[model samples]
Target: MYIPPSSTSPSAQTTTIMSLKTALISYFTFFVVFVDLTLASKHHVINFRSPTLYPESLTWDPSADHFIVGSHRHRTLVSVSSAAAVDTLISDLSLPPNTTIVGVSLDHHRRRLLAVVHSTPPLPIFNALAAYDLRSPHRRRLFLAPLHDPTTDRPIANDVAFDFSGDAYVTNSVGNFIWKVTPDGEPSIFSRSPAFTSHPVDQSLPHSFCGLNGVVYSRKRLPPRRPIKHRQNVQSQRR
Candidate 1:
């Protein structure tokens, strides 16, 4: 004769239901947290619609509430807004024809915009850092400092960074060094290292010859009052 199986006790059934409830709660909590994270990490995109204008670098202007972009093809500094409005902030006739405006830095304290202008390949003749008056009604050209290193055959000024004392440091990609420019528009080699040349480059990559493309200055990293000996000690330790 066949016998029926025993049913689960009431307590066991209650425990099973509680376990299922706990699992469902955990799944629901995870789903909510995942959705929250997805929403929090979402970002908005702003599209700039100039097909010919190949912009190389951009910096935000807090005072004007827009972005200042340097054009590689048009050789102009353009102001782009979040609303997709594109306007030429500066169209410098002083720049050589067909030259590119690679890097731009805005000095809010001095009310000036510094740009790196250079000629690419075929004939890389000109390389300079040009400054423009940001507050001027006509956006007047302040100064242009030629960045030519005698040792570098084809020095390309790739990027610029301004220090607290209104001095500008420009990077030479081909020569792998930095050029320092004073407020009076005097340009000189600031820093160079054998390590820059020693860094191995991938032969398969395009423009593998280029080095030291960008630069930045931080006051906090090395305080002005710090002793030279201390700085030397730090450098020696790092080496």
Candidate 2:
């Protein structure tokens, strides 16, 4: 049966068809990753999902002031800045073909970058924590030092963060757990279990959990200091 096209013009129909194809391709390519960039007018843009490749995670480097795009299939990290002609490839790793980057963060003074790679096969749901030392100009690699227990195979990474003290934090979407990665490559728990979670599955029930997605190190305000009055009355020796 010959069905009419959505539009009368042939070009319109062709355009529609092309759009659908692109959408499907994007979905398949970027279903495992999500990114955000706000430097340009095209802010809040999802790079890989727009006729691009398997886009993993997106982040901003204050030093470079550029957007970083990481992918699993490509196993590469690309950076795009307003000054550059196009995205520049930074790191290439031997990670899984279906890996997805969940978070990216940076520390300015220390000249460091942290990334969390979640490896999922046939599905984007595996718990793996990968990081990189972005200070080097020649050495580009994704060093994945597993944080999860070797015994308990869990799901994917949802978020990552770094503190001013060089401490790292990660969120597991499926395991309902959070881990803190030390500067010395040690993994430990940052918060209590169920740290970050999704909404309740029950449609009738109403609840909200802060969906832990991008864990970035930010400047948290310190508590105010107490006022101290030192009254050293010039001891005028009125002897």
TM-score of 2: 0.58
Relative to the true structure, candidate 2 has a C-alpha RMSD (angstroms) of 20.6
**Per-residue lDDT of model 1, residues 1-239, tens digit only:** 43233576777778878998999999999999999999999886889887688889999999998999998997689999989899999999877889999989999899899999999878658999999998999999989999998887788899999987999999999888899999878999998988878868897899887899878888776546844698788899999
- TM-score, model 1 to reference: 0.76
Q: How much is 231 displaced in model 1, in angstroms?
A: 25
Provide the TM-score for each candidate, comma-separated: 0.76, 0.58
Global lDDT for candidate 2?
0.62
Name the candidate that leads on lDDT.
Answer: 1
Which regions in candidate 1 have their CA more than 4 angstroms from the true location? 1-40, 202-205, 222-239
Which 10-residue window in model 1 sums to the lowest lDDT?
A: 1-10
Residues 144-222, model 2: lDDT tens digits: 5576744345555667777878887887654556788877767876775442443455535442232345555569787
Which pairs clash in the backbone of model 2? 126-155, 126-156, 127-155
Query: What clash count goes with each model?
Result: 0, 3
